[model samples]
Every structure is written in structure tokens, then in C-alpha cells.
Target: MRKMLQVVAISAALGLLHAGPASAQNRVTYKSAKTETSYYQMGVQIAEAMKAGTKGDIIVTLEESQGSTQNVMEVRARGGDYVFTAPPPLVESAQSGSGPFKDKVDPKFTEIRALFPIPSLTMHFVARGDKGINSMADLAGKTVLLGKGTFGATEGEKYLKLFGLEGKVKLADAELSNAVGALKNGQIDAFVTAGSWPAPNVIEAAASTGVTVISLTDAQVKETGREKLTIPAGTYAGQKAPIQTTSLPVVAYATTAMKDDVAYALTKTFWQQKAAMSSGAAWWNGVDQSLMPAITGKIHPGALRYYKEAGFKLNPSQM
Candidate 1:
């Protein structure tokens, strides 16, 4: 009886040890910027899907980092297996390696991969119609609140520089909600945010207080190489006419260096179960097969494999 009991105990210990390594190999870590709502939510959906499809063999661990800059850095350092990032920043990082990560890393630190393009994030420079802040050019010498530590701040800075208004504008970073409140309370002259239509905070604030959405002129759009975007009439609670706007492209990526097979499996599962991703977040409502290419970057080998298998002809030049 004693010998039989020892054998059972030893077998159980070995099984537990083997399970640990197996679990570790299948697990992936993801880092995202807390300020990006859609990216954060997408991460949740992907993680859940991965867990479900892999029968828990694959586990996704997520942590909120500073922003795109930090997310890329963490991925490069192998601190995480995947990251969510915007296109401009991702391009800037991979091409120049000089902005947020200047002097600390090489340009090739990241292997750019395509995930999906988010709907364009329209730039809204909100101010009281009575404040006399009518256009981007008029932002000169004005106190402005740029959405705090978010992609909006990055876009605001980019546009300000393009229009030679950087030095003329006094910019401060404020959380989206706080910036809206400040604008409503007359504490700030204007608040700049870049987001898809009906950003809840902006809509709620605009509804509560009469706010003007500034439009970028054609000349401004051409000069900045920005896309001419519009917030359709009635997008906001009270706004009537379509709000003419302009925006730089905002794209997101599921960047990972995992084996192509692993990446392929995940991407395939994600596309097959797209509806599952939309269950909790409206943001995923826009993630259809048609919108995939707008995400600029090299598709992960795994994703590429799946795409090819699906009868999609991918041009090498496009990559």
C-alpha cells in the first residue's frame, strides 16, 4: 500500500511541473496605452477569444502602458508579446527612431505588422461659439487643452506644427472629461480631441453647453496631407448640419513576433468570430473584413498565412 501511494504522489508532481511550462509557452503578454479606448477594448476581446479558442492553452496577459511610445518600446524590449499602436506613431517610430524613443534605440527595433484600421479619428477643436475661436489658425496665442497623453495630443501637435501655429499656441494636456468640463466652465479657451463620431465625452459636453466644432479649410487639409472627414449631421445630440472636419489616419495593430502558425491561428479565429468581439464594445462594430487593409504595416506572417488560405490575393508590393 505504501509503495503504491508513493508512485501516485510522484506522478502527480511530474504532471504539475509539465503543465507549468506548457502553459507558459502558450501564453502571450500584451501592452496597450490606457488612453486609447478602442485599442484597449480590442485587446480585451482578442484575449478572451484566444483563451476560448485555445482551450486555455493560450492565455493573454495585458497591462496598460503610457501610450504608443511606451507600448512600442515594451514590445521591442520583449517585455510583451504584443502591443496596440496607432499608425502615425508606429510609422514614425519604425522610420525615424528619433521622436519619443530618440537616441535610445534602433529604427529596426519593431517589426511592423498590420491588424486593422480604426475609423478615422476626426479632429474636433471645440470652443464656445462666443469665444471667437473660429478656426485652427485662430488658435494662435490661445490657451488650449489637448486631450491628455492621448493620440489626440499627438495629432494636435502635428497639425499645430504643420500650420506654423505651434509656437503661437499655449497647449496644456487635460483628460478628455476634464478638458470638456474646463471648456464648459470657461476655464480654457478651447479643447482639441481626435476621435470617431459621437465621442461620448464630447457629445455629452457639447449637449450640455453650446460648443462649436471647427472645420479645417481645404487649403489646410491639402497642406497637412490630412484626410477630409465629416461628422455627419445629427452625429452629436444637438448639432444639425454635417460637421466638416479633417483628420490624419488613425490605425491600430496587433503587433507580435510569435511564430507564424500561432499568429495565423489567432487571426483566423478572430475573423471567424468577429461577432464575438462586437458583443460588448461598439468600437468593434467597425471592424469588418473590408476595413482590414487600412491598417498600414506589414501583416504578420501568421496573419498572412491565414489571408492567403482564405483566397485573398495579397500583393507583395503592398506589404
Candidate 2:
């Protein structure tokens, strides 16, 4: 009986030791854009980086999102482990209870905090190369598709109105994911998509069927109050000249509900894997410490710790 009791005790101790680290693993939920979009692929890359960086100590899971607006709204029900992507302007709007979030105000919006800057959202107005749609005004009689409930959709509509082509252009009633297909099938003459450049769908459409990206005139771009961005020549198939467009900076965020230590790990891991990630995805190369000022809201305390340790400067607004 004594010998049996000793063996049982030893086995119990070994089991506890093996279970300790597994129990300590931190799980996080990441939400971004639609599955077919570049933003969604970004979420996947981040999740993979987190898993590899922490060696299974921290696990990040992705949740398919319709757009940035839905990502913000989910924060109300999501706990601390929830991480999401959105533009600084949207975060500000949520914080102030204005714009799309005006009527859906909740205290959870105040809990939101910044993590790090991701790639900027660059608008792409793609049309069939053979079509005569070379400029915004060319779309006067063409059918266009702008995915609903996304920054691209809203911005596309706003641009049409700003450029005086609102009612003149026929809007397609279809999802953004299907925009490329619709264009290829001649169901739509053009489509507007916004994501990090070299957007997956855009590349597919441009490669399989030549497409033309509209270059906004300087005056039209300025009227929208968005920063001008120029897509380099030859960025897409058959695209020979630089395309002038507008962009909105985007960022990752979390709420105070998350623990400080977990946030610290997430921030640290992201910077560490950034180089490796950029090697695989060109969009990641666009992100650097210089864009910190573009991040809205206060930085999460956990992330701030990593930034301080790394000696990265932060804007006053971030503090």
C-alpha cells in the first residue's frame, strides 16, 4: 500500500507540471475585413505571427468581419481579449457618438484603446482597360459596384457626390467581393475597392482581365480632404502610369478589458515579426514607427510599456 501511494503522488505532480503552461496560454480574438480582402489576409498573418512568436503561449483567433463598423460595434460584447482594426476617424466617431455610431453609443466605446498602426487604406477605382472610363467623370453612364457596409463603399459614394457623378452613374446592387467578377462578366463597368495596395482581388482581376485604375485629378482629391497617395507605375497588370488616389491610415485596437501583460506581449510580438511578415507581404513594408502619430485614442497601457522599453516616441495624443 505504501509503494502504491508513492507512485500515485509522483504521477499527480508530473501531470500538474505539464498542465501549468497550457493553462497560462492567452487566447485573443481578432476581427478585421471580409475573408476575400487584404485586410482579412492581414488578420491571418497576424494570428500566425502571434502563435509562432509566443510558441503557443499566446493564441490569436480571427473572426470574419463585414467591415470596420462591425468591428467597433462588437467591442460592446467582446471581452478584453478582443482586438480589432479600424481607421482613426472611425474610432473618434465611436468615441464621440457621431457618424455611423451616433445612435448606437455605448460606454464600451470609451474603453477602446490603440495597439499599433497597420497599412493605410488606399482607394482603388478599377474598370475594364478597354472601357473608356479613364477618369471619375467617365463613369457618368457606367455601372459601378461598391461593396456595402465598408469604407470603400461609403467613400466611393461620397466621391461620386463630391465629383458630381452621383445620380449619373448606375450603382450595382452587389457585394464588394463580387465586384471583380461582376466587372469581368460585363455585369458592371467598374468597381471601387479600398484596402492596402496590391489588394488580392484587384490583382486577380487585373491579371486575369486587364483593368484600368482611375487617377483622381489633384483638385478632386483635395476636395475630399483625404491625403493623396500615388500608386506606383506597373503596380497592377497593364497599369503603366502612376495612379493618384486618397488614403486613410488604419490601426489595431483593444479595450481596457484586456490584461496589461497580454497587451504587452501582443505589441512586442508584432514589432518583432514585422520584418519577417513584410518579406512575405509587401503591404507590411509600408508600416514603420513613423506612422505612430496617425493612431487615434490613447495607447493601451500594456502596449505603451513595450513602446517605452523599445524607445519608440509617441505623440501627445497617444499618451
Candidate 3:
């Protein structure tokens, strides 16, 4: 009986030793764009970084999102373990109960806190180069797909109206995921997509079918009131010149429901792994401490703790 008792105790101790790390693991759900989008790819990259950076202490699961608005809406039901990506403007809209969030406003929106900036949402108006579509005006009378429920779609529509192509251009009903395939088949003349450049879909479209990224003129860019961004020459397969466009800054965020320590660890892991992540994905190269000011809303206390420790200066609003 004494020997049997000793064996049982030993087995119990071994089991706990193996289970300790597993029990302490923190699981977080990271919501980004559709699986087919670059944002989703970035989520996968971030998840890998989080797991490795934390030595498996933190596990991140990627959730396919419909749009930024949808990502923000889920905050009402999500707890601290929920992490999402969205533009600063959308978060502001949610906080003020304006724009698409007007009818679905919740106080939980106020709980959203910034973590880190990813990549800016740079606009791409891609059209088949063989179709003689060289400029925004050329989009008139062409069938275009501006993906529904996304910032890209909204911006595309606004540009269509701004450039006087609204009633002239035919809008496709197909999903944006199908846009590249449709364009390659000559079924759609052009498509508007927003992602960090060298966007995968745009790359595929340009490489397979030869696409032209429409550039906005100085006057046109100024009229739109969006910050001007230039997609340098050779960004795509056939592109030979720079394309002027606008961009929306995007950031990672969590709610106040998350523990401070978890947030701090995540923030720290991101900065530490950023250089490594950038090596794999060129889009990550665009992110840096300079863009920290673009992160909207108050920073999560845990994330703030990491930032301060790293000696990053914070604006008053971030506090």
C-alpha cells in the first residue's frame, strides 16, 4: 500500500508539471478581414509572432471579419481576449455613434483601446491595362466592383461620385474576393481594393492580367480631403510609374476588459517581433514608432505600460 501510494503521488506531480504551461496559456481571438485579404494574412503573421514571442504562453486565434464595422460591432459581446483591427476613423464613429455605427451604438465601444499600428489602408483602383483604362475618368462606362461593407467599398463609391463616374460606371454585384478572378477573365473592367501595398490580390491581378493602378492628380487628391500617398513605381508586376492615392491608418485594439498584463505582453511582443515579421511581409516594413500617433482612442493600460517602458512618447489622448 505504501509503494502504491508513492507511485500515485509521483504520477500526479508529473501530470501537473506537464500541464502548468498549458493551464497558464492565454487564448486571444484576433479579428481582421476576410481569409482572402491581406489583413487576414497579417493576423496569421501576428498570431505566429505572439505564440513564438511569448514562448507559447499566449495563443492567438484568427477570426474572419466581414469589415471593420463588423469587427467593431462584435466588441459588445467580446471580452478582454478579443483583439480587432480597424481604422481610427471607424473607432471614432463607433464612439460617437455616427456613420455605420449610428444605429448599433453601444457603450462597449468606448471600452476599445489601442495596441499598435499595423499598415495603412492604401487605396488601389486596379483596372485591366489592356482595356485602355489609364485614369479614374476611364473607369466611366466600365464595370467595377467596390466590395460592399468595407472601407475600400465606401471610399471607392465616394471617389466615383467625386470624380463624376458614379452614374457612368457600372457596379458589379460579385463579392470582392472574386474581383481578381473576374478581372482576369475580362468579366470586370476594374476593382477597388484597399490593403497594405503590394496587396496579394492586386499582385495576382497585375501579374496574371496586367493591371493599371489609377493615380489621382494633385487637385483631385486635395479635393478628396484624404492624405495623399504614393505607391512607388514597380510596386506591381507591370507598373512602371508611381500612383498617387490616399490611405487610412489602421491599428490593433482591445477592450478594457482585458487584463493589463496580457495587453502589456502583447504590445511588447509586437515591437520585439516587428523586425522579424517585416522580413517575411513587406507591408510590415511600413509600420514604425513614427506612426504611433495614428493609433486612436486611449491606449490600453497594459499596452501603455509597455510603450512607456520602451521609451515611446505618448500624446495626451493616449493616456
CA lDDT of each prediction against the hidden true structure: 0.68, 0.91, 0.91
The CA root-mean-square deviation of candidate 3, after full C-alpha superposition on the true structure, stands at 3.4
Q: Model 2, range 1-319, lDDT digits (tens) per residue?
A: 9999999999999999989966689999999987877888999999999999989888999989888899999999999989999999999999999998978899999999999989999999999988988999899999999888777898999999999997999999999878878888999999999889878788999987789999999999899999787888887888889999999999999999999999999999999999989988988877889679888679999999999999999888887
**302 in model 2: Cα distance from truth in Å?**
1.5
Residue 241, candidate 1: how far off, in angstroms? 3.6
* TM-score of every model versus the real structure: 0.72, 0.86, 0.86
Identify the superior model by lDDT, candidate 1 or candidate 3. 3
Reference-based TM-score, model 1: 0.72
Question: Candidate 1, 49: how far from true, in Å?
Answer: 4.5
List of clashing residue pairs for candidate 2: 80-258
Whose TM-score is higher: candidate 1's or candidate 2's?
2
lDDT at position 52, candidate 1:
83
Clashing pairs in 1: none
Q: What is the TM-score (0 to 1) of candidate 3?
A: 0.86
Give lDDT: candidate 1, residue 235: 64
